[model samples]
Target: MEQEQQTICPWCMTEIVWDEEIGPEKHCPHCDNELSGYRTLQIGLDQDDQAEDEDEEDTSDEPEWDAGDEDESYGGNGSAWKDTDQGFRHTNRAWMAVEETLRRVVDEQEEAPECPSCREYMIEAGKQKLNVEPTVHGAVGRPLVQSPIETTLYVCPSCFNTSSILSDKDRERMLKALSPQD
Candidate 1:
């Protein structure tokens, strides 16, 4: 039996195949663009060919650490603040969403948050379980009060971090209703 020619994407170099279901003369599914050229017995940029292009150097010179790294990581240059400084401290990317959700939960019925001892409002960024759940189920009909997902808390103003758990029962119920669905 003979095989039809295989094409590759110019942008991504992934092998392309035409599928009747996808449509005739389809784009390289890998890159989702038009396909051109015919398949050869062997195709793609060989190692030596790729290496040649890679050897070409950037025209401009820059400091080793300064090149190809995010400026924010470098403390925006020459500031007295270091990585440990409050200003330089990490903000959990999800902070605002988590804090507002938690605050709304606080506003609703039942349990009071132990009112974080920290001087500032605390934000819930993401959660983790520092310890393992006890495996054995207490009773079949009774739903296990699954352990809390340990969460990292950050102070709203300082972004100082801490953590605690509502009781297993409370945490389970609160998480179902308050935490982001997705």
Candidate 2:
């Protein structure tokens, strides 16, 4: 009897057993990622070396500031600072526009339903009417669902999966009707 060798997939964390006749697997069966260490990465750091490097400030590239030097690049004439200020203002304006658009798209619903397939927030597309037979059972005892029940349709932007939920009015009516009678 021989022991079977197992390799753990780095991408999906699934344990894979190599077959005796097939030898070792070159790729992970679960995630299909290469098991040959091509996609793997390792990082190491020394805290003492990092602390020493941080303590030594390298100012070799920086130009010395002098009051007599009136160069525009050295901020002596204030042109560098003005250019930086303008760039900052432009960046802020662009960021503000992006935030406004995001707010309009994402904040439409306070409690938006998540798509079952992609787990992304679904946007309300439109209303749909479902014709249900009165003889169909709504509950164990309750028969007769209201015909032409209205439902709100939602579409997932990411996966384009369409789903529907009962309208607020119809949901309330169904809840009230299903309540146990005194």
Candidate 3:
């Protein structure tokens, strides 16, 4: 089995594919921060594992809540806050959804690629086509030719650093389009 080497950017904590090609001015491809003396850190699925471990621990001393327990504890009408129990349940569900979304966003940030310039997490901005049109010198009836190069763009949310690169397939297409036709 081949072990893949990886490194994390100290500034952004983004995982980077380790390559010796990085020179003395070694900059993170994601955050563009110097990595000369930085040490590699291990990342694991420890958060989930820890959570599972806690769930498995005994908690028999904790009191379980019954229906209308909140009203009994507070000595107030529960319906004063919400019309029905179903309404409270719906609100709880909505809050749970919101919490889940927040968790997902944080997870995405943890896994996001670092911005080369800003050392922050970069997000996919959009796809754009860079067209290189052939210059025409007043040609009569010659069809205009242009090569459309498609590229994916990423942007740093912090420093607004933007990067664009063509995919392998797009590079092949661009090369074919630019090459002289038979």
The digit string of per-residue lDDT tens for model 1 on 1-182 reads 43455666776888766544544455666767666553456555567677676766543465556534646656666343564565665668699777777678555624333435555545444445555463543433333335544544433434454655444555666546544455
**Model 2 lDDT at residue 43:** 52
Rank by lDDT, highest first. 2, 3, 1
Which candidate achieves the best TM-score against the true structure?
A: 2
Candidate with the larger TM-score of 1 and 3: 3
Q: After superposition, how far is residue 106 of candidate 1 from its true place, in Å?
A: 12
Against the hidden reference, what TM-scores do the models get?
Answer: 0.21, 0.47, 0.29
**Candidate 3, residues 36-61: lDDT per residue as tens digits?**
76768676776888867887785577
**lDDT leader:** 2
Q: lDDT of all predictions, in order shown?
A: 0.54, 0.76, 0.65
Question: Per-residue alpha-carbon lDDT of model 2 for 1-182, expressed as tens digits?
Answer: 66688888877888999867778898898788898875644555657687678767664665676666787574787768777665465457887786676557768864478899999787788889988875645454665357789988888877889999988888877877677778
lDDT of 1 at 169: 55
